[model samples]
Target: MRILAVLLMLTMLPVASAKEPYKAKPGVAGNITSVGSDTLGNLMTFWADRFKGHYPHVTFQIQASGSSTAPSALTEGTANVGPMSRELKESELNYFASTHGYEPTVLVVAIDAIALFADLHNPIEGLSLPQIDAIFSITRYCGGEQPLRFWHQLGLEGQWANKRIQLFGRNSVSGTYGLFKQKALCNGDFLPTVNEQPGSASVVQSVAYSDGALGYAGFGYKIAGVKTLPVSPGDGPYVKPSMVNIASGDYPLSRFLYLVVNKPPGQALPLLEQEFIRFILSEEGQKLVERDGFIPIPERLIRRQLNKIAGDV
Candidate 1:
């Protein structure tokens, strides 16, 4: 009977201890506001959906003006966080430091391949980096009166030179523009004839309708109607834009996306900010990244970032 009672007490202790209700950290309640980077806007939306489970009391407010607006919004105290697809420029950083007295903490979320797309009906299969550079750099190729209208004129094997090349691009404020300028053209100025759209979806749609249309956008915008052009840095075969290719660094145009906050967010900010960033850097989050048409930065790199961003949490 003594042994029986002792065993029963141990079982009861386990059950009693397990009944203690779980509670989050004391400072974990509130709302967080983020602005900028239309290119990454969908990602934040996805994170917000899952984040509420971990932070029931926290609310997330997000906006997509453009990547360039982040630092200004941060310094002006209009937003607690900023989502940007481009690395912060030195001038912007200096401005933020001078105005806000601290540089914003940058958090990399995922890598996105800048996908060059064309109309599905267009037969051209590949483009050399130089040809691509020439197409976008010189107005005479796509803009002037005697534009290279056919596929053959653009150096495609077929004799289709008169098929006018319709140029599409993101608006000047877009991070896609910045990335394209840096990676594709090496900061070359965009030709004046390129038509600019407000978002990636629009770019995809516009390119899909024209026979010789060409546009650049983040990987997330790749869809069936528009065919992605293979991009290479001259080291290997033209690489298709895909998660596998981007993750392996086979695609030359892929670049990192980042989350920027005005400062180490104040205590008033929602706890979901950290939790959401943690989830984005987690294996599960990275899987979502691949599923969303971007490549997950390698696990080793992600672990390093986790250490820097959320290791203590």
Candidate 2:
């Protein structure tokens, strides 16, 4: 009887460990406000929901307008947290410095790739960065010396030959838009003919339905009817935006997603805010990142962010 009981206990150990939930240390209850990037909106909401399960008294006010608006919300004291898909502009940082006398804390939470998409029926297989620049920019830069207005310029044949390229992209307010302009367009202005959408989803939807449409958005927003185009840096061997490619730095458009906060000099973050950020950098939180279709920050980056947070505290 004793031997049988020992065997049974051993058999249940693995199951018990697998079913154990992540434990988060509780903190003071308060309302937490977040505003920023539409790209990080869904992921932030998921984090809030899970965090609330640990601290039931905590409430969240989240607004995902655009990354460009995050700086204003933080400076105005309307939001305590800012989620952004791109790095803060120098002007934004300077504004915070001028107001608070210090720089805000920036933490990288995940990785994303800006994917170029076209209607599934489009025969074009891929594009170089220069080609993309020419397609979207009014004043082409990099290696794209002339504007590519028609499909024939991109080597498409048959009915696509002379068809005018229908461009769709995020508006000026989007961080994704800014990043695309910087990396793909080489800081050139967008063409006047481009249709500016309000959100990533809108860009994907427009491209998926319009036969001649081409647009760019985060990899997570890819839809079924649209095909993602492989991209190269003005050369051959174009790479698709895949998990492995983005993680390995093979994807040209890959970028880090961030969480921003203003911490007073020589002071720690607010109790609730610190706890929330701790939870976000935890292994369980990174699991949520992977679940949401974004790449998790690697272990090394995670350790660096945690150490930075500790230093701030």
Candidate 3:
């Protein structure tokens, strides 16, 4: 299903505001540790700072290694919040379910799209899905007869023709890597030549400075020196990862970002965490989402998540 349509027509429009404000309770204080999703690092920080505004005594510690770290951190009780840019794998979900005797609560917090970034100098029109597969993967399982190693292969001419296609990507532990593998590469293995960056900023910066470089990163990372390529499924029109395109389901790569918590079935979370979550589902929390350059969750999904945590909250 399309990402936006699936999230209760998150495709509808921008979040004007939630139905109510976050009701901050008295003496809400604690340390909140968030682990995972380099893509969500800045966003988590934004939300944390907002939450702290209402509860000054609450401190926060956030780590953004990758989404793979979230399940372990949440399962081991090392983090109060585990933000992920993608859904958990079956193995990760099963492990948590077995260990906790219940599944972790997934909070759909925002929307984002993985952007295929190129150096500003590369004037290529767009890339087809199979071409993307050929550029990044070894197996070429997406109908690529051979690997794409040079710019001229994609129809660039003159000075661009002989330029090598430099590839940058997230490390193995990243949800970006997994999603790109699943969608663009057709689950094929990445080429060994892919320069694996430690975080999203590195990928965006690497592409910005390197000629003929292409990198995949969150759309929020788009800055002055890079270009976001319009990509297609080989037959469809090329679609840019714009907010309108994402919300309209015209952009194929748009996805939900989430915060996962270890709440037991039939149990309300601890007051501090519960209040924090309530705040996240509130109007102001989603404002932080837009501030961070990610799309806010739609109202119905917000209400659905709030109901999951507490009926009255």
TM-score of each: 0.81, 0.90, 0.94
lDDT of each: 0.71, 0.84, 0.86
Instruction: Give the local distance difference test score of model 3.
Output: 0.86
Candidate 1 residue pairs in clash (backbone atoms < 3 Å) = 149-161, 149-162, 149-163, 150-160, 150-161, 150-162, 150-163, 151-160
Q: For each candidate, how many residue pairs have backbone atoms clashing (under 3 Å)?
A: 8, 0, 0
In candidate 2, stretches whose alpha carbon ends up further than 4 angstroms from where it belongs are 1-22
> Looking at model 1, which ten-residue stretch has the lowest summed lDDT?
12-21
Residue 7 in model 1: lDDT: 25
**Decoy 1 TM-score against native:** 0.81
**Mind giving the per-residue lDDT tens digits that candidate 2 earns over 197-299?**
9899999999988868899988899879988999998766999899988866678998888899887766778878888887888877888888888988666
Candidate 3 wrongly placed segments (more than 4 Å): 1-19, 311-313
Q: Which residue pairs show backbone clashes in model 3?
A: none
Comparison by lDDT, 2 against 3, better one? 3
Span of ten consecutive residues with least summed lDDT in model 3: 2-11
* Cα lDDT tens digits for candidate 3, 1-313: 7433467465464654454777778978889999999999998888888889899999999999999999999999899889998888889989999999988888888888889999887889899889999999989999987789999999999999999999999998998888888889999999999999998889999999997899998888888989899989888889988988875557877788888998888878888888888887778888888888888777867877877777323
